[model samples]
Target chain A: MSETLQYIGLGIMSVLNGPELFSIFGIGVPVAIVMLMGGLLTGIAVGATPGLAGPMAMAISLPLLISAFGFTPDALLPVFAFLIGIMKGATLGGAVPAILFNLPGTPDAMMTTLDGHPMAQNGQPKRALRIAQLSSVSGDTFSDIVLFVCAPFLAVIVERYLDLPEKTALLILSISFIAAVMGASVGKGLLSVSLGLIAAFIASGSDLSPRLTMGIPALREGFSLTAAVLGVLIVGEILSTLEELWRNKHALKVKDVENRGAIDGLQRGDIRRIVPYIGRGAVVGTMIGALPGVGSTLAATLSYTLARRRHRAITASEDPQFGTGVPEGIAATEAANSAVSGANLIPVLSLGIPGNAAAVFLILAADSIGGFNPGPAVFTFTENEINPQLVTAFGIFTLMALGNLLNWTVGGSFMRAMGVLAKIPAHYLLPVVLLVAMTAIYFQETSMFAIWTTLGFGVFGFFMRKMQVPVLPFVIAYILAGPIERSAREAFSASGADPWFLFKSPISVAFLVLSLAAPVFLSRGGKKPS
Target chain B: MRRINQNMALGAVIVALALFALFAWVPNDTVSGFVESKRGRLSIGDAMAPGIAFGLMALSGLILLLEARKGDMPGALEQRTFAFLLVALTACAVSFGVMIWAGPLAVAVFGGEGDTYRNLRDTAPWKHIGFVLGGTGLVTTLIALVEKRVTSNAVMIGLAAALALVGVFDLAFDNLLLPPNGDQ
Candidate 1:
């Protein structure tokens, strides 16, 4: 415990006393903290826009940041600080458009539009925004606390008990669980994962030689991770969205509703009314966030449903229902979704598995920045030397706490002001975004090969989406491919070439069994017909 | 009642491909098979992981095919989707082509026969030519495709966006180069 406290102190000092951005009164401000503020503001701005979100912003900023800082140990904290700030700030900022414009700034904020829009239309826009801000911060803080408590414990446990084969089995189990839960069917999800694995396999192999290159020289060094990921997640989405907008060109535009200016502060008893919902949402979001690949959308949906059921049972008939402008609804959704940001890092920091798109970017950052590799080994406590990864982890936590502080202080007003972003036309914005994304990738790689790879992946991603394949599973599987193969190879070699090594141990056998059983049970249990 | 589902049909295709990987591609493409023995010790070969992945793909494809009787997969692309993709790809290719060749062509045209584009690739007017023009063209063309017509406002916005990007990537970061410029 004392050691943990010591590491925490070192982490805080590292963040506070790092290379200075500038000095005021002979006191230098740390670069990481300043970047945190910058990222938070940028995140809020982007999240307020209809078509933009946190991950896109992170993806665009990553290459630029890497170029600025290079791949150095000192770069990790500032880079991660900015990314985590974006993750937190975007969660809070998403509620703005949901309330004011009846548009969800982020996908998880779709639930917010139900009650938030009504609250705004009823001349309580600021009240709704304030409630969202408070609830989001409450949930985010709650989950950050959970993350701070849980991640180290989980990582320690994983590191202690999981051997090579068990680790391999655990990875397979994670993939199976993700495949089972995402996409239309388990089959499609597995197919997506397989394709991703194959893609990752191309131009990559054991030290012997490259596999699946098909004689292309460029294939010798596999596709650029950033280009491929951003292509699918950002560029493909842009293409799809633009296509939909073009198809619906003749559709009627939504007329802007006049705002009824009224006193907009939360009235007495409002906090009391929403506290229970917030608590429930935070719990639900944290639990889901701990699981790899289960995202905040599910958390918000589940929490909103549970809150609605309880609200209906207790409230008077005229007090307002879940879908029609209720503070409780906003509280539930904002709390649940915002809570997901911090807890999502649990998987990334503990298992080195990304739970969602935001976490994926964090993993990419770690991979690109070098020096910091997140996994069970990250939490290793050593007596002789300081574990740098542990310090980085705690430094990340400090940055998250700072982000939450910023969210509490200035995030609300900034979010409210960002409602104007929702008015930007997608046609104009998307093309420019595409251009910028391509340019950014080019500047990073300084190779047209990366640009072409991005375009190729973007096309594949577009078709994959059209075919209803889940893109997240593909991406996660792609990232996990290298690690999974390494684990498998090590386990195989360690077991004296035991082909059934995954089944040799009880823990691994259980994990393998669960990997097979998850899709069958989950698909049967949860899959709904389209 | 059992019509072929598009996803299921795609699954069948994937199954065939996976089978090819297992039976043909993996054996031929990889130097060593699933397992290799070197110095009397055993190790997993490069083909092992892909072989496993392809096997999994085959299994999942079979499952998809089996489920085909239940329902059709949603969100299948229409003909117009392909059309849009074609136009988008064409625009990208054209813009890229222009980005690559425009500066060199302009240098050859404006400068005397002795002055080459390679000499002036990093200079002000020459360096900015391809990225700004190609980027603006790409953006403007995409907007036109979406709006079904070209508008001055769209062109202006596209030009402004391209310039801003050049400013951000080039002027701001002296180390960074725009597309084609980096290639050159």
Candidate 2:
């Protein structure tokens, strides 16, 4: 208890004395606040917009901030604050369209609409929105606290396994886990992952030259992550959307409704009704988040399905109805998704294996900056390089808590405000999305090649959608490929190219066994699909 | 189903081309030369013996296969449109390759048909030609002007400014760009 107090005191002092905090007063607190507000607003705008998630916005803004303001720690504070605000805001805001228009703002918000829209239809929009906000904020705060406590502990354990072979095995295990959890067809998932690995390999550096350039001078430096991601995710999604439009000329019409009002805060009855469901969802989401490849979406779906089943079983016994515009439905989804937000960071922070596309983007961004590394040694390596005054793992927790608190207090009002945005026409919205994507790609390297690559990837994305292939595995595979290949190469070199040596390390053997066993076990108890 | 099968075959061929580029054209010249040199050290009799054995085996197999099944070649018109598109695409690729030496505008003009530009309001041949030439010229000139005006130092400064912007957002807000790159 005393140690915890000391740590808390140190964290508080560090925040107070940090250069970032000092610079704010010099610039005037009002000006700093305004800048932070601007960042928050911008984050909300980007987050609520499809194809403009948190990472992309940061990528687009980071270079501009660096070039405009220099590398002062003070300048970064507001931006970071804004990103967190945006992440929290956008997630909640996503359900606005999902509830009112039947269109999800982001893919992750799909499950929210299931019961949320029904409540809205039943003239209880405010109630539904309130429950979602409360559950979401609660889950988010809970997870952030967990992250704050667990990161250092996990970091400590990770530091001891910083060798090449272990890293390689860990990466392999991560890939296997991801492939297993992503979709129903393991063969297709593995194929997609393998394709991503092959693509990354084609761009990796070799002693003679960067591989597979075909004497093209432009490609000599290899493909940039920004370019690859833009191509695969943004451009691809757009092309796929366009193809859908081509196939189905008519748009699906949804009923338009006005924002009713703020959520009358949850009643005691509501709390009692939702607590068990929220708890279950949070536990499931966190567990899913800890694993590689199994992201929040799967967690949300699994939790929702499980909640429905449990709700049914209980109601069947008691002669009660469940899942009909109930707060428990909202609780299940909000808790599940919000819990995933923190849990997903576990693998990335601990093992340097990003569990999802967004996590992959964050890891890539960290690598570009000077202070951090992704592997097991990050905690120790970063401890020395990072400014002691800026060491704010605790502060991060505080901010996350504050962010969620703000979300809970005013979440309903925020959702109502977001409804005003849903009126924008697709034509206008899509063009802005295209422009943002173009500017982001251009800023990454200021090369026309990246733009063309993005366009090409858009076409590829369209085809993949048509083929019913999941794109997530491909993204994870691409990010993991370089690290896995590099680590494997290093491990091979260390072992004098003896393949058996991969299993020689205890960590490697353990991870390999787990990787092999996961599929068999996960698939065993689940009912076979009809 | 037949059309889809043909498309898949075409995809296979395209894949083959890509693989050749990856494995053969992209390898280090020294590596290729070393492999060739080692192969050349082998005796002619050693190489010829294997070739003869493989050829005899193939001949025997082919004779037996001729007795088992036979098939006719595809009709020329069955995939005439697809064949034409493939040829056109191949020509476009060749033109892009040729433009590396001849320059972009020159190839765009000489390699293209007048019908390609026929949709333009400028009906006169010279006007159509002038549009292509003038547009290319203007772009090239503008690029040159920008290059001349912006010194290397200025470009470097611009890059530095961009980096600082990224640093500010990352450090202050904790919102990061992407993998292993941003604050976790």
Q: Score the docking of each candidate (DockQ).
A: 0.76, 0.04
lDDT of 2 by residue, B78-114 (tens): 4433343343234323322322222223435654565
Task: Please report the candidate that would top TM-score against the real structure.
Answer: 1
**Tens digits of lDDT, candidate 2, A325-364:** 6677778887888787777766666677777655665565
Interface RMSD in Å per candidate, to 1 decimal? 1.2, 15.8
Backbone clash numbers for all candidates listed: 0, 46
Report the error of model 1 at residue A17, Å: 0.8
Model 1 chain B — which ten-residue stretch has the worst lDDT? Answer: B1-10
- DockQ, prediction 1: 0.76
Q: Which ten residues in a row have the lowest lDDT in candidate 1 chain A?
A: A249-258
Per-residue lDDT over B1-184 for candidate 1, one digit per residue giving the tens place of the 0 to 100 score: 2224576678789899999889988888888778999999999988888999999899889978876756665547678999999999999989988888999988988877798777887888899898888999999999999899999988998899989987776788878888888778
**Candidate 1 local Cα displacement, residue A159, angstroms:** 1.0
Task: For residues A414-507, write the lDDT of model 1, one tens digit per residue.
Answer: 8888877777776888899888888888878998888888988998889878877788999999999999999999999999998888888899
Docking class of 1: medium
Number of the top DockQ candidate: 1
TM-score of chain B of 1: 0.93
